[model samples]
Target: MLAGAARPRMPASAARSRLVEPLSGETRLMLRAAQLYYRLNLTQDQVGERLGVSRFKVGRLLDRALRESAVRIEIVHPAARLVELEDELTDRFGLGGAVVVDVASTGSEQDDELLARERVAGAAAVHLASLQPTGAIGVSWGRTMLEVAAHLRPGWTAATEIVQLNGATSQSARPTRAHEIVERFGATSGAAIRLMAAPAIVGTPGLRDALEQDPSVGETLAAARAAQTAVFSMGVLGPESVHVASGYLGATDLAALGEAGAVGDILGRFVTRAGGIALPSLDRRTIGLPLEELRAKTLTVGVVAGAGRGPIALAALRVGCVRVLVTDEATASWVLDHA
Candidate 1:
């Protein structure tokens, strides 16, 4: 059945439908399919019959329509998730994709942070799992990454390899949980793990050079560079940051980094608001893949939560270190508003 010469009448089920945007060709067909399946309350078979195609083809077209924005579904409810925020973040930041998790305050600041972290991590884990990633995946170690690992289901990937993107040896007695983060990701995926057994920052550039020269460290760094996909978290510059808590940096160092316009750290390397190295001296002692290398990766998913994390997240997006972002609603809104 062709969409013929006669002006098509809006079906009874389409009373609430409206054409808000212009489309043509395949997009027009997509919109038609969407209208038939959604507004007209037609099943895939019915829609396909009207459109003169197989039901399987209709399914693919409907999926493509949603992906291409031929149709937009808005959920209206008291607790409706703000799906638009994800689109806005991707558009505003030029991101490849975004996942925004709905998070409500839990009354206590501590509980709220914990809940938000879990929500954001769960979203990231699901997104990663959906990708069906294989081969070497570069990852960073931190609280956020740990949460992400915890949320990942078994066999998230097949025959994958996990490479630590940066040195994780903490200067303090408190555990960085760095190894645990990589190991957990590897264990779930049945992957081969390559750990960077060294401090994130050494006392001097020469010491950093000597450590990188080691075969084990060099091999891991090489794998990190070659991996096309990476997942990590942005670290806000603050007293509560993992670097400070793990003793990789101290109060005086944080003060220096702040004075240098550092907004956050990516892969343990602090960067400015404009995504430039915040401090050359500090970065020289840092052991990890350079910030510029991140831009070349096929996928770099940055998972960050908490209101205070907005600046770093924005910096990561602007710098092109992160292609996809998984974060809570408040943080996403904050990034969009501030960006």
Candidate 2:
């Protein structure tokens, strides 16, 4: 008989009651500790007395039960986030705040990618709405930003203004949806919308300056500069990048950027692995908020998701451009592990 399963004289029927193998002494102790500590809500000292062991041993047994899968704990919430990951991100990156969306894989890479973006966008929308800003909010245009705008509810915030942070005019046949994103944000928040009516990039630096001097564009840029909060998304350098698709960049331009060690882009400005600008001349022609200005904002919210975006996200955090971050669990973990 096992140490705890003492045997005594019993009826034949009682002896035959053993229908399954007995648990090992250690396994039995672990289960008992888990039951007493968790189910019974007993203190370690009390459990130790019942189990004839020290309180230290009881704690170890409880830990073992959790580690060996003898016990499981789940947070029963539909939109529960990983608070541990959020804490780790905020602490590790020196961020003001961090939100890690717990996204489950959908068994397909493409679908999973889309789901991750939607989850992050939803979280971003919630975070933004909670701020309840009554002033201008600088914003950028992208699919992720559009998703964020869609997630926002009407009357989410009142007396707010939306200022476009970057030029949205795309040279490609594909629309950038720049106007739509800010319009939706303004409509949802019941705020005034100021759109940047200019190309993201021009043929020359001189042309870019001329456009910036235009009254409407100049007013919008001034509004962006005065805004205390900025919300934006990032893009990884690839053929599928919106910059490439928008015709602001072509194959050779991307190749040159890659050669300069760019990992990704923020606010139409590309940066290297260490977050330094990859190409200054290209930045000179791009019309938007200067990258350095992002760090000066009272709040800068960065929303990014999907695989292969860790490098860029990490770069953004390191550069101090992202005071508040909203991303998927995988991306948050990758940033912490690599940071």
Best by TM-score: 2
lDDT of 2 at 183: 93
Candidate 1, position 147, lDDT: 95
> Tens digit of lDDT per residue, candidate 2, span 1-339?
347665657778765658654767988988888899999999999999999999999999988888988898988775555788888889888888999998899899999999999999999999888877668899999889999999999988764799999998875798899999999999987899999999787768888888888887999999999999999999999899998889888888889899999999999889998989998888888898998898899999999999989999999997889989999988988888888
lDDT values for all models? 0.88, 0.89
Which pairs clash in the backbone of model 2? none
Against the correct fold, how does model 1 do in TM-score? 0.77
Clashes of each: 0, 0
Error of 1 at 160 (Å): 2.2
Against the true structure, candidate 1 has what lDDT? 0.88
TM-score of each prediction: 0.77, 0.80
- Which residue runs does candidate 1 get wrong by more than 4 Å? 1-81
Q: Compared with the true structure, what per-residue lDDT tens digits does model 1 show for residues 173-204?
A: 78788899899999999999999989998889
